[model samples]
Target: MKRELKVTSDGSKTLYMENWDECYHSVHGALNESMHVFIKNGLNEVEADSLHILEFGFGTGLNALLTLSERGGRSIQYTALEKYPLSEEEWNAVAYGRTSEERVAFASIHLADWNAPVEIESGFVLKKVETGFEEVEFEPNSVDLIYYDAFAPSAQPELWTTELFTKCFQTLKPGGFLVTYCAKGQVKRNMKEVGFEVMALPGPPMKREMTKATKPSNV
Candidate 1:
């Protein structure tokens, strides 16, 4: 698995896998994509003093770093799941941070021990879990928001099934949301089948649509 670092449109870096022809984030703009899809649309929608965020693919730790930048006064507990954890050299090569503070925060997020909650900053706690998406189980209704940053259905069709969305729906609390960069018709239908009220939103960069699924408050 050979990966190379490439600069995105927004002047941010992303890891591109040569063999799979996959990128950790969008080529249009890694920073722009994350800020638009995950932070602006996903995180900002959750009105909470304390947020428990569960992320599917912790590739590059870009979303978490951006969340740290936008957390404001909220206390955030971020749990990121990754099966094949990147090495120090790999994450170090993908420089996603700009300022001195953000650079340090990015390093702290990656250096923290796996499976243990580490307070990366005053208002942010990070826990990196080393496990594949299907292998782990979560306590029902445990998460406040989920950043479903998995590869496209084209790359991993098995992950986009109703069974996985059912697990995602069950794991989210009432009124919680699941935001993803994918808006495939089948994906939205699968989410709806598992009792999620799905919404189609404008996507970032060159994409047309994104999906935001909600576990209704009355559920």
Candidate 2:
């Protein structure tokens, strides 16, 4: 593996080896993008007291930490997939500057064994899967929410292809939502081709748009 781990321009987040460039949280603002996609669009619609969440790229564990901190009384079964996982030192360096509560939660996730189910808190269960995006497997129609945080299409084109969206389509239950910071025309079109109802929405600062795609009930 290449030594690609380094602090980003934001100085608070670390960039990992997956050719992904960004912090776990926005150095500009931590809660901004996360709230828009994950909380508002992803978790808010789930009716079940417990929900199954799948994150395509568990970079920085920022989204997971934030979700656990804000959502109370609901059980969350989170399965995160990553090809090149971050090391403990890398996670700790970036996580320590977060809220004390979030810092604690983030530590728990980083320490848990990969590919094995681990309980992060009373209502949250986390499982980290270390595998290539193409090889990571999940049951069809099983995931309630998906955090599509892969690198930009320019950097990692394979992750943004139609075949990848097709896999995501198969993994979602009816009404499940897949949220991402990307709203490129090709990305949206590819998602639509895979049977998802794609929505273009306002993105974080410096970005013009984002995307949220839902699996149809009929599919």
Candidate 3:
């Protein structure tokens, strides 16, 4: 799988996989999509003193970097899953971290050890899990939020199956929510089949819709 660096619409870089015709983030704007989909729509929806988040497809650690940067006085325990971790060459090619502080944060995120939790900074603990989403096991009712940032269903249909979303339902606490850039009808149906209250939200640039699935509080 050969990956090349592509400058997105927002001047940020994303990995373009020639083999799968897939990209690590949206081509419209890599940073734009991440902030809109994962931060605004996902993290902002939850209001708590502390949060436990499970993210699928860690990719270049962009989402984690953004979340850590937005501390807002709340503590976050982040567990990210990455089946195919990015190599140093791929990540280094990204043109992020304009400021010296941001550059340091980016370096700290990528340098963290895998399969073990490390406090990248005060109030931000990150655990990088080197495993596939389906193969990973999570403690039931433990996660408060799920960033389902896996590749599109077209690229990896197995990750979008009803069974996997069922596992997501079980892993999340009551009233927890899962967010993703995908809003395909079948994907929404699969989430519904597993007792998730699904909603279609506005997508990022060059896209139409995104999905936000929630576990009911009473269930």
Candidate 4:
């Protein structure tokens, strides 16, 4: 797959895969899309004092960086799954952090050891798992939130299947939510069939809607 870097509407860079014809983040605005879909809609909606988040596809590490930047003295345990990890050149091409300290924090996120928990900062801990979704064993009811930032259903239909959503539902704690930029009808139906209460919310720029699914609290 050939990858090209392009600046988004908000002046942030994103990876465009020529083979898949998909952009890693929204072409309208990569940073804005990440902030709205993952942070504002997913993270802010949860009231937990501390969070244990599971992210699907840690692509450019934009969601993780934004989440870390927004931590308000709250403890966060972030577990990101990436089967095809990005190269140093690919990630370094993105410019999310402006200041020296922010840039250092951004670099540390990529440099963190995989398959083990490492404290990136005072309140942020990251565990990068390098494996396919089907191969790993998820501890039941351990996650508080999920960032389902996988490629579009058109590009990777396997990740959006009901079987996987069922597994995601099982991995999440009661009341935990999963957020994604995909709002295809079948995707929502798959989630609902797997015991998630799905909702469609306003999307990022150039997108009409996004999906957020929640596990029932009483389940």
lDDT of each: 0.91, 0.79, 0.91, 0.92
Model 1 poorest ten-residue lDDT run: 12-21
Could you tell me which 10 consecutive residues in candidate 4 have the lowest summed lDDT? 94-103
Q: Which parts of model 4 are misplaced by more than 4 Å?
A: none
Question: What is the alpha-carbon lDDT for the whole of candidate 2?
Answer: 0.79
Q: Comparing 2 and 4 by TM-score, which wins?
A: 4
> Candidate 3, which segments miss by more than 4 Å at Cα?
none
> What is the per-residue lDDT of model 4 for residues 108-127, given as tens digits with 9 covering 90 to 100?
99999889999999889999
Q: For candidate 3, what is the TM-score?
A: 0.98
When sorted by lDDT, best at the front, the candidate numbers are: 4, 1, 3, 2
Q: Tens digit of lDDT per residue, candidate 1, span 30-105?
A: 9889999999999999989998999999988999999999988899999999987888999998876879989988
lDDT of 4: 0.92
Q: Evaluate model 1: give its TM-score.
A: 0.97
- Residue-wise C-alpha lDDT for candidate 3, range 81-185, written one tens digit per residue: 997888877787894685788779888989899999999999899999999888987899999999999888898899999989999999999999999999999
- Judged by lDDT against the true structure, how good is candidate 1? 0.91
